[model samples]
Target: MTRESEALSLRVRRVLHAPRAVVFRALIDPDELARWWGPEGFTIPGVERDLRPGGSFRITMRPPDGEAFHLVGEYRLVEPPERLSYTFRWEEPDPEDRETVVDLALRDLPGVGCELHLEQGSFATPSRLALHEEGWSQSLDKLDRLLTAEGRA
Candidate 1:
């Protein structure tokens, strides 16, 4: 859920059914990210990554019934299993959209799994922030399921 929100920022925190290191790997690894990185009904067909500070990354997301979307980002920081920071922008950005920063943090939770803390934005408006909130909520739900079912796949 969104931890807090202001005119220019959004924060959300979620606990996943995996360890911090495992969740971190899923976020940084292209193959694993492809499994659960978009809104519900959307699938990521490809990802190219250079997971180091200042490195670039690209991912193509295909919705079941819409045109594909391309997202490009540059890593701002890579702190292994604990934190990641990046800049996010769409290749075909909306007229009102601009590059935004996203910071992801993972904290170990002993026997309860791992905590994912996501803080993103400076969205052009509250509506835009709402859109991101919906998207990320669905995507994170997918991530939870993917991690829980990892042993089966």
Candidate 2:
């Protein structure tokens, strides 16, 4: 088994028109993931999800430059529509470091919308944190578009 590692995380607020359950389902459901899985222009060619603990959730992200980054990780915690904490490690990380933890949470806002929060911690340096901040921010924007397109918002 791979060792537990650290990552720098961020907390974000996303108001989706759908209920917390619906938003959470979109995140955990593999079939629904393809629609909004990458940062802005990047594409997701493959995705595999396991909804239970110890299951593997893997995705292949294809950037516009044709670079493919395979994100392979295991599910550490899973509570539908409420919380999900996972171990996110790149398949081909820099030889020096190879792992990080990403924790995601969902909260219902009583007829308003769902709040999606994320915490990605344990990064070794501030640069890595900054890099991920950009990536996740872009990805969240894409998710907004996807949810809107799906008529969930």
Candidate 3:
């Protein structure tokens, strides 16, 4: 994995040990997403998605110990097995929270697997960026493990 950061944005790259199609499906399939969508110890109790441009999704996240919260988003672009872009915002935002855009690109690596590039941006502050960085880091780690356990690795 590799990461690049700016004051209000972040980029994360990961090489998943799975085919591009497999990884891409996991991203858009609500059932697959619920299996590995959050940071360590976080569980997704509910996931609702309409997978298409202009479609929206809402996910309920239950932390290790706390009331569940929600994050909602609307799809801006959805290109299967390649790209997806969406607007992301917390249902109940912090003082520094603001809606942001998330873009994902999946590239196939012949004879190997796939590479995922994730970019999210225009945060209200560096601290918010850091928080998302950590979350994505852990979430991606979970994704890797899931693919591996499923024998896609």
Q: Which candidate wins on lDDT?
A: 3
Model 1: residues with Cα > 4 Å off, grouped in runs: 1-5, 151-153
Cα RMSD, model 3:
3.4
Report the candidate with higher lDDT, 2 versus 3. 3
The digit string of per-residue lDDT tens for model 2 on 25-135 reads 878887677777777788888898876899998899998898888999999999987998888888888653447777888888887778888887667666777777888
Candidate 2 stretches greater than 4 Å from native: 1-7, 95-97
By TM-score, how accurate is candidate 3?
0.95
Q: Which ten residues in a row have the lowest lDDT in candidate 1?
A: 1-10
lDDT of 2 at 90: 83
* Estimated TM-score for each candidate: 0.93, 0.87, 0.95
Listing every candidate in turn, what is its Cα RMSD in Å to the true structure after a full C-alpha superposition?
3.2, 3.7, 3.4
lDDT of 1 by residue, 1-153 (tens): 343335657789998989988899899999999999988889898999998999999999998998888999999999989999999999999987878899999998888798999999878777778889898999999999988887421
Tell me how far the alpha carbon of residue 126 in candidate 3 is from the true structure, in angstroms, after superposition.
0.8
lDDT tens readout by residue for model 3, 1-153: 223335578889999989999999999898899999889999999999999999999999999999999999999999998999999999999999999999999999897789999999878888999999999999999998999988996
